[model samples]
Target: MTDAILRVTGLHKSFGDHHVLKGIDFSVAAAERVAIIGGSGSGKSTFLRCLNFMELPSLGTVALDGREIGRPAGGDGARYYPEAELCAVRERVGMVFQQFNLFPHMTVLDNVMEGLVTVKGMKRAAARERAAAELEKVGLGAKFDAYPGRLSGGQQQRVAIARALAMEPEILLFDEPTSSLDPELVGEVLRVIRQLADEGRTMLLVTHELGFAYHFATKVIFLADGVFHEVGTPDEVLKQPRQERTRAFLARYTEFGF
Candidate 1:
């Protein structure tokens, strides 16, 4: 028996002949904040996507809360889980993207209520109540009626986060959540994420913010060339990396004063 909330084994992903992820394996315990750090083309985003089957794995098993997801049948890579099963898996694993991915046509409240009402079969009154609370959690209660177009980049991103939180997911996957914002706007989004971290929300994040990662992540995995070159506490991997590749990668960030 394992206490891990999520377990990924022998994960591999390839686009034609170009292999992006090469036999990666890791398990995330409940409430663990894992930061996946690497230079460009290191498969960080791909690895994150595979967790929720957003990008199907070429080979691997993903188990959440003890049950396996999208169990590939046979040796062929063509078979996949039915849409219904995938939907169930996704409901427990929410994602926040680099781009705010909000619906411009809908008000912030409507955007957050979409998944709850449509996918979760929530009633309008119930979903609206939940959506309002989620928005408040992200400090956006006042923007409920505002459209995405009316909000600043940071505000829009908070809407995105609130939308995900409205689902009450077991784990949150963040793919460079602050990357699309202007420099001045990144702090607000980061502050919200920090609050979630402090509240012990299980999260897996791919980020370039070294300072944030160092301060926020409980575990840091330094990936290079499709595999984790170093995995340890943030202090161990970020401050004193064991592998040359990990050291070299952090050195670049150091030069930039990150």
Candidate 2:
């Protein structure tokens, strides 16, 4: 953990009266692929979003590459991060949400290029080149000129992946990237993500595809009611969990080989 690429300590998040995440601590070393699994309302998405300051945590600190982000505000003791600081963290931590979240009006290539040009401030031509390269990596180079509306759900998600990769993030966060895709399309997106894992890309993924997680993760964490119920290697956590909560959860995924 001392050499962790991304680390969280005492992480907590509350939405007004509802506490989504509570006192969670986690860290991933460079090139580690972490798979987080849990039932709905287990704070999985909230926890992932908090890492990038998208859904600000009510407490705790997140660090990237040994540098902690945010600071305590004087009065209430809640963490406060400046917009500039958050922007920089985002550039380092790329995220893909459950939904494709693509721009219907923009071509696939333009959608991928936007972050590079606007946020990274790269020259237009350079951004275009990088975006094209990333798209190619996701096997969507042929779809560059198509709009999100014109592509299948799987292809749209691939475009989202290309956009995230174009930023060259130190780590990638995937929040159920295939959740919205049809069953037939899920495999295509999983294949691309699997390829990234094979390449040793650092990633944290929240997914229900237990079979894929069994094969894809270096570490598997089981979250329950905002806490890590169990954490270990895929075989230990998924196949031979130490906690009753984790066992019950895995039982429901019997067909998935979890």
Candidate 3:
């Protein structure tokens, strides 16, 4: 098997008039922790969405473990991704959103178990067992029956993580995982991410936490004008960034807490 779990080549995306990604080329190895950081409109989130095929690329290819993730159907008429193929690819790539996208009508356990039963075809009892284990992994075993409306922002995010984990995905994508939390709650979420990294999970994160990026990231990439302008080891990119844009961005965070 190829060591690279994710391979994107010449990826491009545009939102009508705005070109979000301009020929992005990158590869992520198994169990690698890579952080993508940049200014608000640098296309970090869009790039992440493209990885999971939530936002299809205008021109490019994304492959996971040697399999092309999404492609158009050929003239023969059969869909290249027939619905099932797309679902399978999505299953292998679990994503945790900034809003924590939990179902308001379901309990924490139910939210986690729903996908397992519906997508993976697991029995209720087995799915619950697996869900419980995942909740426990995210320190949410006690909130299994609690509703999303009742939990704090941090706890809700933990449930989201557990929900994703229940599928046992090979790779995880975190889009601004801590951006929506209260100031004091960011640490709790970061702690969960840190634990996952310590356990050697393959993760791709888009975050503004420079401190965490400096400490946890195996590689740090800086985006500018819809492209990865700079990339290097964490220390090289975050601490002694060679690009002027990167240095200026860090300056604001350090001095004014932007």
lDDT of 3 by residue, 153-207 (tens): 9999999999998899999999999999999999989999999999999999999
Candidate 3: residue 204 lDDT (0-100)? 93
TM-score per candidate, in order?
0.97, 0.97, 0.94
lDDT of 2 by residue, 1-258 (tens): 589988899998899899889899999899999999999999988888988888988888898887889878877758779999999999999999889898888899999999999998899999999999999999987887998998899999999999999999989999999999999999999999999999999999999999899999999999999999899999999888989999898888774662
Off by over 4 Å in 1: 76-79
Clashing pairs in 3: none
Candidates 1 and 2 compared: the better one by lDDT is 1
Candidate 2 least-lDDT 10 residues? 249-258
Candidate 1: give its CA RMSD in angstroms. 1.4
| Per-residue lDDT over 1-258 for candidate 1, one digit per residue giving the tens place of the 0 to 100 score | 289989988889999999999999899998999999999999999999998889988887888887878656787743476788789889999999999899999999999999999999999999999999999999998988998999999999999999999999999999999999999999999999999999999999999998999999999999889998899999999998889888888888778562
- TM-score of candidate 1 relative to the true fold: 0.97
Off by over 4 Å in 2: 255-258
**Against the true structure, what is every candidate's RMSD?**
1.4, 1.6, 2.6
Q: Report the Cα lDDT for residue 171, model 1.
A: 95
User: lDDT score, residue 76, model 3?
Assistant: 38
Between prediction 2 and prediction 3, which has the larger lDDT?
Answer: 2
